[model samples]
Target: MNRQPEPRQAIALKYDGKQAPTLTAKGDDELAEAILKLAREYEVPIYENAELVKVLARMELGDSIPQELYRTLAQIIAFAWQLKGKFPEGFDPDAGPVERDITPPK
Candidate 1:
């Protein structure tokens, strides 16, 4: 018999000026839809990466990301900040452009 694929998964993380990004929400199927809906309602930017979501889904809510994922997550966060046209705290506009070439985990 053919089985349906697993429902879509989503993970949300929040990074304030000080602390590392923490997993705030995670869900599958309808709960995933609700998470996306709330994010849209609040005008939150959504980044889609199924592999990244799969890795992050292993963590319990409120857990800071592992150091191994720091660089990858930083790139994602930086991209989000750029989309919002805002820099992270202590970012120096006068410091000239920063170059980054990030490869997502396999």
Candidate 2:
């Protein structure tokens, strides 16, 4: 029987107003490179500022895409599609649960 490939989710890499637009990549460096290559092929300006890029590059799957960056990218992509944006649906970047200590009080 033939099976359908799992849907790949896109992570938006938002930035501050002073920075450029970007997209988040999986942890694998090569995978990230490939994603960046595609973005470049489309003539999209991928921001490469040191300080900002450094922080974004380190974002892991479990971490919530920071609010500032989230808003920035959301707006850009929203506009890029002329407000008929196609954000990765059902991809809740902040859906993870919070952790807490359960040690007994002294």
TM-score for each predicted model, relative to the true structure: 0.83, 0.35
Off by over 4 Å in 1: 89-96, 99-106
What lDDT tens digits, residue by residue, belong to model 2 across residues 66-88?
55665445544545543333334
lDDT of 1 by residue, 52-101 (tens): 99999999999999878888888888888888889967888689887865
Which parts of model 2 are misplaced by more than 4 Å? 1-23, 26-32, 68-106
The residue pairs that clash in candidate 1, if any, are: none
Please list the C-alpha lDDT of all candidates, in the order they appear: 0.88, 0.50
Residues forming the 10-long window of minimal summed lDDT in candidate 2: 97-106
lDDT of 1: 0.88
Residue 46 of candidate 1: its Cα lDDT?
96
TM-score of 1: 0.83
